[model samples]
Target: MKRIGVIMHGITGRMGYNQHLVRSVLAIRDQGGVVLKSGERVMLDPILVGRNGAKIEEIAKKHNVARWTTDIDAALANPDDTLFFDAGTTQMRGSLLEKAIKAGKNVYCEKPISDTMEEALAIARLAESAGIKHGVVQDKLFLPGLRKLAMLRDSGFFGKILSVRGEFGYWVFEGDWQPAQRPSWNYRLKDGGGIILDMLCHWRYVLDNLFGPVKSVSCLGATHIPERFDEQGKAYKADADDAAYATFELEGGAIAHINSSWAVRVRRDDLVTFQVDGTHGSAVAGLTK
Candidate 1:
C-alpha cells in the first residue's frame, strides 16, 4: 500500500470541498480505496490543513479523518512523503505550489494553475526542475458528455470535423433576494478569478485533446452586472468579467466558437451544450433532460 499523505488547504471553499475533499480523496477512501495494477493499494491519507480551525474540525469529523492542522509548515515538515494537492484560491496558488515543490512534494493543482500564463508556465517549470510529478486538474474532459464525445471521435463518427460551437452559462441570481452562490472573490479581478480564466482553461484542454491544438484565439469579455449584493446584504462592485466570447483557430484548420457567461438565465435544463459538425455527421451534446 502506498501510504500517501496530502496537504490540503482552502477546504472551506465550494470547489475545494466538493471536488478535492469529497470527490478525489474522501469519496475514493469510502469506496474501500484505489487499487493499483500491481495489487498495491494507493491509499491517500489527507491531513486536513487550512486557515480556519473550526471548519477544518467539522470537515475532519465528517470525513472521519483524525489528522488535522492549521499549520501548513508543520505538515510540510511531517515525515510522510506527501503529495501536495492545492485547491486554493487562484491568487494564492503560485507561491503555495512553489513552497510545496521546495518541500519535495509531488503537486496536483487545480486550474487555471495560476492567474497568468507566465505564472502557470513558471510553476510547470519549477515542478519539472524539481523532478516532481505535477498535474493540473482538467476535470471537464472526464465528464460523461465529454467522454461520449471522445467515444464518437475514436469511432470516427464525425468524419473530418469541420467546425465546433459551445454554449455555456446561466443567469446567476443577483444574490440580492438570495445570497450569491459563487464566492465573492470570484468577481474580483485581483483575486485571479473571472469567466474567461475560469472557463477557457477547460476549453483549452477540450479543444486541444478532442478537436485540435488551438493555433490562435480572439476573445472579448464584459461585466454585465457591476453591483452584486454579498451575503451580509452589502453591495459590492464586481471587477471581473461575467461573460466571454471567444473564437479559436485550431492547428488542423478546424474552427471553434465558445460563449461562457454568468448573466444569462437557463430556461433549458442544459446550461452547457455544444454542437460538432463534420463532413459525415453532426452531434449535439450537453446536460439533457
Candidate 2:
C-alpha cells in the first residue's frame, strides 16, 4: 500500500476541523483508500498539527486520527510527510504555506493565500521558484450544480451565453442571542475578514472556469454592519466589507455580476444562487438542487 503522509495544520478550527479533518480526510479514511489510474492504492495518513495540543488531541481522539502535535516545524521536517495542508487563520496562512513550500513539501491551503494581492502573488512566485506543487481551495467551481452548468456549456446549451449573475449571502448572527455560525475572524478587517475579499476570490475562479476568462472587474464594497460581538462576548468594530456589489467583463464579452453579503436574512433557499443568461435559454442554480 502506498501511504501518503499529510500534515494537517489548524484542523482544530471550525472550518478546518469539521470540513477538512472530519468530512474530508476522515471520510476518505472511512472508505478503504483512493486508487490511482496506475492501479496503485493510495492511503491518507494525516497527522493533525495545531497550537492547541489538547484541542487537537481531543479532536484526534474523537475522530480516531492516529497522531496529533503542536510542533509544526518538526512535523514539516518529517520526510515521511509529503503534503502540507492549511485551513487556518487567513492572516497567518501566508507564512505557514511559505514554510511548507521552503521545506519542499507540496502545499495546499484555503483561498486568498494572502490578504494583499502583492503578497498572494509573491507566494505563488516563491512556490514556483521552489518548484513545489501548490494549490488554493476553489471548491465552489466543483459543486454539483456548477458541474451541471459545465455540462450544459459543453453541449452548447448556452448558445452564445450572454451573461452570468449570482446572489450569495446570509445573516450572520452576532454572538448576542444565538452564537454566530461563521468564524469570528470573518467580521474583522485586520484578521483578513470581509465579504469582498472572501467571496470575490471564489467568484473569480467560478466565473473564469464556468463562464469565461474575466478580463476586468468593477467592484464596490461596504461595511454594512459596523460592530459585532466576537467569540469572547466583546463588541469590535467591523472595518471589513460585510457586503459587495461587483461586475466582471469576461474574455468572450460575457458580463458577470455577483452581489455577496452577510447582512440579509436567507428566505429563498437563497444562501447562494447563480443564473446564466444565454441567447437560446436561461437557467438558475442554487446551493443544492
My TM-score estimates for the predictions, one after another, are: 0.96, 0.96
Q: Write the per-residue lDDT of candidate 1 for residues 46-90, one digit (tens) a residue.
A: 898889998899999988988899999998887694788888888
Error of 1 at 107 (Å): 0.2
lDDT, candidate 1, at 116: 78
List ranges where model 2 is wrong by over 4 Å: none
Expressed as tens digits, the lDDT of each residue in 32-129 for candidate 2 is: 78888999888899999999888889888988888889999999999999999998887888899889999989999988898888888899999999
lDDT of model 1 at position 60 = 96
User: Against the hidden true structure, what lDDT does model 2 obtain?
Assistant: 0.87
Error of 2 at 30 (Å): 0.8
